[model samples]
Target: MNSRTPRPPHGSSRAGPPPRPGRRTFGAVCAAVGALVLAAPGCGVLSPGSNGQTSDDITVTSTMIREGEAIPARFTCKGEGVSPPLRWSGLPDETESLAIIVDDPESVGGAAVHWVLYGLDPENPELPEGTVPQNGKQGQNSKEQAAYDPPCPSGDTAHEFRFTVYALKADIALPDGAPLDQALGAVASNTLARGRLIATGGR
Candidate 1:
């Protein structure tokens, strides 16, 4: 026998195989995959609404009408019309220019276009309550007028007028009185972002 002495054998305690290098590598790969999975979309890794928020999420208010304010009937008729005041926030910081379009979506044939205005200052947070200057350039509305046409919905049903504000990367090239389709097309090609507000009136 050699000089060294072996210890007493334990019950079925044979030596296991040495740790495998491949297993360690596989574990590392699995860890990386897990990290990527946790960082993907809907994983709460990104900011909420970073892609963009819906019109409902924006804070759109009018000085004339409170958050739940009811619109007056006088503004709905042909006489003594005052454009409602509007205020907005939460616009994307990259906005370069602003456009405003107001339309009656309840029109019988498709959504009707009411007011189309591009090239407003995006820096300005509000449109002073009232009709924009008549002399100001008018985009082609459904009636072919370039001004705010108050809703004169028939029957007792309330009609919603949607005011959409587009944030553009550059000023639209069309002249004052451009057609609705053309203006919208220009916006589609150049818009950096947009916002909207809605108010309802019935007669």
Candidate 2:
């Protein structure tokens, strides 16, 4: 009598052989590597609106507005919409350039970047009202405008605006009308010291 071939053990797949232990481990490693690769883009040295406060602080002030005080109407949308006069001191001796960033923290979508002025001469410790320093470059604000966009908070609640000055160790060479992120990144990376003057604004 002819004998029939015995069936394979249960749980054994006939379609293909079971995966080897080495292959399974390799697959797991590949999956882990893939996960790491996918997560790399979001891993940045600095988050938006953060300037890496790892160094000394400078003293920033304004002639027309005091810290924590309501900003003058001339500097807001309700009036002439001109930039406010600002001053700062305590710059490190190694500072080679200066930058200014004005923003409103209470904005709807993150901090509204009102103005980004970089490549200012370190020799000038103050900026006149409504003036861009000589040879300074302007960056796009939250409205995508290349010039200063005065703070205009919606609703009746007053919004606090930050006028930050960065003292950088190296001069930035960004072109005029650079993107806000690019200008901020350049300022933050080279910042040797910084200061802030907080003021409020409303409709």
Which candidate leads in lDDT? Answer: 2
Model 1 scores what on Cα lDDT? 0.51
Candidate 1 on 1-203: residue-level lDDT in tens?
11224333121111212322311121222242231111123221111232343132335676666432345655555544555667777665556656776665554443455567766555566776554432224465555555555556556665666666666666677777775556655655565555556666665
How many residue pairs clash (N, CA or C atoms closer than 3 angstroms) in each of the candidate models, in the order given?
0, 0
* TM-score, model 1 to reference: 0.62
Give a tens-digit lDDT track for model 2, residues 39-134: 113322122334444354689988899988888888888888888888888887787888888776565544466778888776667888877765
Cα distance off (Å), candidate 2, residue 133:
1.6
Task: Name model 2 segments beyond 4 Å from true.
Answer: 1-53
Q: Which candidate number maximizes TM-score? A: 2
How does each model score on TM-score?
Answer: 0.62, 0.72
Cα distance off (Å), candidate 2, residue 147: 0.4
lDDT of each: 0.51, 0.65
